[model samples]
Target: MNPAVKSLADRIEALLPQTQCTKCGFNGCRPYAEAMASGEAPCNRCPPGGAEGIVRLAAVLGAEPLPLDPERGSEQPRAVARIDESLCIGCTLCIQACPVDAIAGAAKQMHTVIPDWCTGCDLCVAPCPVDCIDMVPVTGERTGWAAWSQAQADAAHARFLARNARLVREREENDARLAAKAAAKLAAVQAEAPENDAERAAQERKRAIIQAAIERARQKQQAAQPRNTENVSAAVQAQIDAAEARRARAGLTRPGSDQNANTDPEEK
Candidate 1:
């Protein structure tokens, strides 16, 4: 985006509810604001902003104020998620689904919502298997921007960004660990000397499989590494292509090559 457009998007984003909710048909408020700044999305998609929010957005964009799009959702009092501990099944699906890290618990353990942290995005409700989660209205009779504040929105946006960064870091760490283990296994296998041609072929096959796994893990880790820009370097792309070819070859190896080699001719 150009500087002017980016500035406009910043302003538009600042005026949003920062719910990180997907109700606007976009991934989050930032994306929706960018779309509006670029004229891709209309200003009335945010139900959290309600009519007043639409007016604010329209004033910013020099467009006529429009009513909230009912297709997105109707404006309602500010709400927060509540988990019924009695009915809770201890699944962590809600925790993973929460965009702002509002839900807290472990696998096979009852989860609780941190009301202060919750943006009431209604993101966690759908993922609950036991249907223990509920959206309880907090600001009764106060809906839309009237029920929300800029400070709350800013805090929610910060938490949403932090959660995303943490998830990426966790994934990259896991991929690194997997790649390390595969590399160690490959080295150990290579250290052993085959007694004969059959054993040598089997060892080679095992090494190939391990190498392919390591390559995949490396690629995954690289992709998980957050960057300001995208696109793999030419050298890295070439390495990936080579690894893919090796993986394909490993898959195409005769299914029973090792067994066939070991079996006696009479048994065959």
Candidate 2:
């Protein structure tokens, strides 16, 4: 913000309740105040401040007092949240949802609210999954500024700013860690270099060994088959047939052909 606008915004911000409830449609009271000072938004949107807040804003800006915009909300008693520990499932949703970080707990652990830091914004109640959180009235019969003091509002605003800074820092750190891990994983994948010359040579040797073994097996199978009858010489086959004919004519058994049958047992 420029010095001129900042001065005006600070003046406007000083009058707000700093609920940071976003009821005014901005993220927090400072943004709402800045918008009002910039003529972008009206001064009566804060229900937490009620009629008095509007009047104060109007007076500082040198404008006519406007009625509190009922569309935002009606000003009433301030509220503080309470946690039913018995019902809490330790989801930590309420802790994450608390704008001021007034609720404290880890994931899967029960949470409790700090009364001193509570802004009565009721932001943390709805996000509780188990319906364990409740907003109870803290200032009954008192409304707006009467319900909350300026010191408390200022303190809440400070805490809100601090919480915002802390969240941003944590998010940035997590992003950096994730990026580094991704880069490391990518490097690891790239490290598996392509096959070297030695590996290629070893593969070639194994292939040659396998092929030689297969050739030997094929040759062995061919050698086991019976010799073809056509491979015998024609002259030799004719001579053998003639010899068999002569033997038959002589009433003699062919050589080496059923010799036991030709010899009688009485001859022994």
Candidate 3:
């Protein structure tokens, strides 16, 4: 690549979301940038970049009127990536899919999205079998993009430390809450507990008696039920035969079945 073209490509890439969603019908932002610079690819290929990106590119390149390529996708509201911790198998598929390397985690480790780095490409959402990833808009008091970006970077850096200052504060607060809850729970349990040793022994004896009664009742119920092993076995065998016949009709044979029906085992 020529230095001039490379410089132009870098500028174009800077304007892109870097999500690497490939909505542009190219491999990634760099390829799309190169194509656009060479006039082979249009400026409207990016959906995540939206109208803002189009307008910016147009202004830079002094291009004529062009519509956002509908074939690429539509410009939706800005969204941040979120992972449903419950469904996430931590396969690191999303991590690999992220163009910017916005997702962080090892295989089988819980992955988190860096909101600032996430381009809201929706690329990671599809490859997930568990459907755990979701895109959510930034709500509450709105902060400008520059500030948000800085804050996101700071957060990412903080995560590298053994104990982040912000996390330590949060942990302290959570620990206080948990400690209070534990104390309350202990009090409640103590109140409900038998008052004296004799009372505790009596309660244990009653529990034992109730458990024995329940066991006896279960045993009696089992004895009363008629066992029909022959009938059960016959039903199971019928199902197996039906399945085998279906497979045979479909040109699949059971193991050790005659490969050549014309050559009989009796002849051998």
> In lDDT terms, which candidate is top?
1
TM-score for predicted model 1 compared with the true structure: 0.82
| All candidates: TM-score | 0.82, 0.69, 0.49
lDDT of 2 by residue, 1-268 (tens): 6778878987798789978888898978878988988889988899999888888999988889888888888998999999998988777777667766677665566678877778988888888888988888889799998998987886666556545544544544543444454455445544545499886676566556545544544464455432112223454355435434543574431121112222223334
Tell me how candidate 2 scores on lDDT. 0.69
Q: What TM-score does prediction 2 earn? A: 0.69
Model 2 clashes, total count: 0
Candidate No. with top TM-score: 1
The better candidate by lDDT, 1 or 3, is: 1
Which runs of model 1 end up more than 4 angstroms from their true locations? 225-268
Count of backbone collisions within predicted model 3: 0
**Which residues of candidate 2, in runs, are more than 4 Å off?**
196-268
Residue pairs of candidate 1 with colliding backbone atoms: none
lDDT of each: 0.76, 0.69, 0.58
lDDT at residue 9 of model 1 (Cα atoms):
88
Better of 1 and 3 by TM-score: 1
Q: For residues 133-252, what per-residue lDDT tens digits would candidate 3 score against the true structure?
A: 998866434322322343442332222121122223443454344445445544554455788999888767656654554454346434543211112245444543453344346542
